[model samples]
Target: MAKILVVDDDSATRLLLKRDLKLEGHEVELAKDGEEGLESAIAFKPALIICDWVMPNLDGVEVCRRIKSDADLFATFFILLTSKVDLDDRVQGLDAGADDFLSKPVDPAELLARVRAGLRLYQSQLQLSESNRQLSKTLRDLQKTQAQLIQSEKMSSLGQMVAGIAHEINNPVTFIDGNLSHGAKYLDELINFLHHYQKYYPHPVPEMQELAEEIELEYLMKDFPKLLHSMKRGAERIREIVLSLRNFSRLDEAQMKAVDIHEGIDNTVSILQHRLGGIELMKEYREFPRVECYPAEMNQVFLHILNNAIDAVRQIHEDTGQIAIRTFPRHDGWVEIRISDNGVGIPRGLVSKVFNPFFTTKPVGAGKGLGLTISYQIVVEKHGGKLECVSQLGEGTELAIAIPIRQHRPPHSPSDSTPDR
Candidate 1:
């Protein structure tokens, strides 16, 4: 049975309504006036409240307004008991938030019917509230799933491209690197033999002297070794670049492994070396244990953050920029990477939104705006860590990444991969 509260200044009226409502199968409570009615309504938390228009302290219209205003009590159906039947009086009652009005000299049949109607409306409201809550949860889940799918597709495409490029470049680099030393040795031997012949026979035949003078033989002998050394150095540099590319890709070692985070950071820096022309790159790495992580993905995170720092400095048209990177192990089994830049800092208002997908300060087409968003996911969601940014307007920005030395979970699936960009 529904719990109902009946309020009236007249004891006789209160008793009458109580008797009638009880006979109609509702559990009824009594109140001598509007003040008492409000207190009882709060304490009893009734499904419906019947309040008289005239009362000692608070009136029925005021009581109904209070009930409708309260978040907790707003759902309770309110019926105002009034003697005035004038059109304005009815309108005033409705304006005060009354759900329904019962004409004084209450009709028992009419009152019961109205009570039933109010209860039905309340039930509908409850159902709609529940449905809306469920819909919101479903939408959140769908969005998360969609983001994972997109990330998977991106990583898969990137992995394929990087692996192919690294493979093609590695073979030629290895060949040149192996043959360069032999070529340098051969040149050195030839130069040494020519020097010995010159030393043994100080004077040559007139034709030979003329030939040596014409060809600048002395200069050739002096410069040839240096030329070979330069070529070998160039080949070695190319080989180092190829190695960096392979490290950055790390496709074969996609599974969780003990990885040097410093190596990953260095590889990323090497790949972005061209962009660091006027930037002073500083590294303050303290000795730390190899972290268990997906090296390639972590490298990507470093790339994204470093690229952004470079872009920020460039945006201000700075002739020279500064990017400082520091790494150290936290006592609590976590490793911290702090990357900061002396560039145009993120605005205070936009700092919090930096990691939100598609939110960028750059002009349209300049950026896809997914770089930091994807970085946050890789550091936090995939690794169970934290990624945060601190910035001041017109100053600079610092991004801090902290992850456990060893992940607590198993390797992530393709759907959990970081974004390709």
Candidate 2:
């Protein structure tokens, strides 16, 4: 049985069609005029509408046009009933999206047959809609899967490279760092002993003076401490870099653990030091508890966002770029990390699309536009948090990521509520 609507100004015609369709074991609704019919069609969503050719105010054609234009009613079969059988009239009805036509003084058998045929067409339309919906869902899932696979491969490669580099650099840096203090101390002692010898025996042999001059002893004595101090600083810088690399990779801490959020942010910044030569970074960090999260994955989130910030600021050839990072704990137990960049800001209309997969304003070969999309997934889906963006034209953009301070037992599920936006 199917739902059907009958619209007509004539009382006899309405009664006849209603009795016939109801006797056919179908749910039928009757409307007195075109306006009433259009209302019923929308609210009831009938499978078929049998409308009169002409009526007061709005006509059958106009009602049919409106119904066909509606997305939800696009597949509702329409049948026009009229007394005039002129070819021109038929064309006009068809032009208004009428599916089938019925002549006045309708026969019960013909009405039933047409209704059955229209119902079959409606069912076919529904099936097609369902198929299209399923296909769309499958496409979205496939896109999401592809993005994850690519990220996973990159993560694996990066982890291996970072681990190897840190290890190799740490070994040599440790050697230099360990010997730097002793070397500095030894140089100081030798210089002191040389000064004492010079004081005790002011007059020395011609051979000793000639050797001292050849070695530039006066300048060496003055510069030795400075050179040794510089070497120590360099070794320490290398050690710091290596430490940052290891912390950013977090390969050893694969599982969820309590981690310093500031440490993760600093580690990411340290790794990006080469790119920040001309940019000023400002950090406004608030006191917050160590967040329980997948440290490495969270670092990846920071990496993607910071890289985007770098790319944004790098575009402005005239101005020195600035990226500001602010972190604070919310009263609702979620910590928010906001990264704002004063570069070429995103257009107001496109700010929403920044997180869409494969949607990029970047020129070809520059980027794949999956950075924010993947970041959104990690912060929202993996951590059960909210990723929000606020931007204006030429006014820069700020991406705020909010996640819980403590991860729930399920890790992915949320015990506390995250921000809706």
Candidate 3:
């Protein structure tokens, strides 16, 4: 049952409304004048209020205006009672926030019907408010789940990359270790023979001379230095490869730091070098400032975009694909990097869905389709940057990324908690 309040200057009128409304199974309260009605509306928090339009201190119109002005009381339905039956009087009552009007000598049947209608409206408002609260809670929960999934995917990708790099490093290390051992042994044997020849063969010995000729002593001496130099060069190459892997992974870095954008791009290119067969890479870099960002995450962004470009080129069966990378500083304290490829371009219809999670055009087992989605989040959400794509079917595609040189705050703010999807 709804709670209602009745206000009138006439004692008889107030009594009639209170009695009839109570008989209808409603809890009713009475006020002698408009001022009392306004007070009781707040104190009792009634679902509906009925007041006379003409009264001594505060009138029904004034009371309705005050009630509607208060946010807490605005939902309470108001009905105005008046002796005047003119259209202007009705309009004035409505303009002051009266939801309904009752003529003088109010009919009991009509009063009950209007009260029931007002009750229905109040109930619906309450239901709508509750639904909104529940929806907000569901949105928060979904965001939390999304964050967990993204992090899990990132760790899985890192594990696979680390395994591949480990395998690549092992081959070069094994070659360098085996070759160094054999080279040391050969050098030791040659040193001992030369020492013996100089100490014991001060005079000419026919046997020693025949042995030297058979072994090709002059050629061996000249080629030994070259072999040692080759081994040294091989070891150096292995070092460079390991360094590139380290730079690309950035595993030791857990927070934002100033990092060279060009270095990160070069490192990513080196890591993906094996898959770049027949793909010509051209770079045009300008002097740019180091940006404050999560290096590992940024490197992952580059790898994702580049990998997609390479795959697009391969799919078209291009004999010699071209991937061009360009970087320059913007006038607004931001750096822009653009990676373009001449390959099978993305269809216009699918361009919008490229950043959507788990959306892929590749065949089953060939892709997870999280690459571009994760990249978009890293650039736009985490770094407060912009990532855009331009593509033309049958021509090529280009992706541009822009990030500020310095971050004023931490990477993840409250708003950033929500995933792009």
Question: Candidate 2, residue 288: CA error in Å?
Answer: 2.4
Ranking by TM-score: 2, 1, 3
Q: Which should have the higher TM-score, number 1 or number 2? A: 2
The regions of model 2 sitting more than 4 angstroms off are 83-92, 205-219, 345-353, 390-395, 410-421
Model 3 bad stretches (over 4 Å): 1-217, 410-421
TM-scores of the candidates are 0.71, 0.87, 0.57
Deviation in Å, model 1, residue 62 alpha carbon: 12
In terms of lDDT, which candidate is stronger, 1 or 2?
Answer: 2
Model 3 RMSD in angstroms: 12.8
The positional error of residue 375 in candidate 2, measured at the CA in angstroms, is: 1.7
Best by lDDT: 2
Report the lDDT of model 3 for residue 311: 88
Residues 1-421 of candidate 2: C-alpha lDDT, one tens digit per residue: 9999999999999999999999999999999999899889989999999999888998888989999999989899999988878899899999999999988899999999999999999999899999999999999889888888888888879988998999999998999899989999999899999999999988889999999999999999999899999999999899999999998888877776778999999999999989887788999999999898878999999999999888878777344779999999999999999999987788888888988778776668879888888998889998899998887766677899999997667554443333211
Best by TM-score: 2
Taking all chains together, the TM-score of candidate 3 against the true structure is: 0.57
Candidate 3: Cα lDDT at 263: 91
Model 3 lDDT on a 0 to 1 scale: 0.84
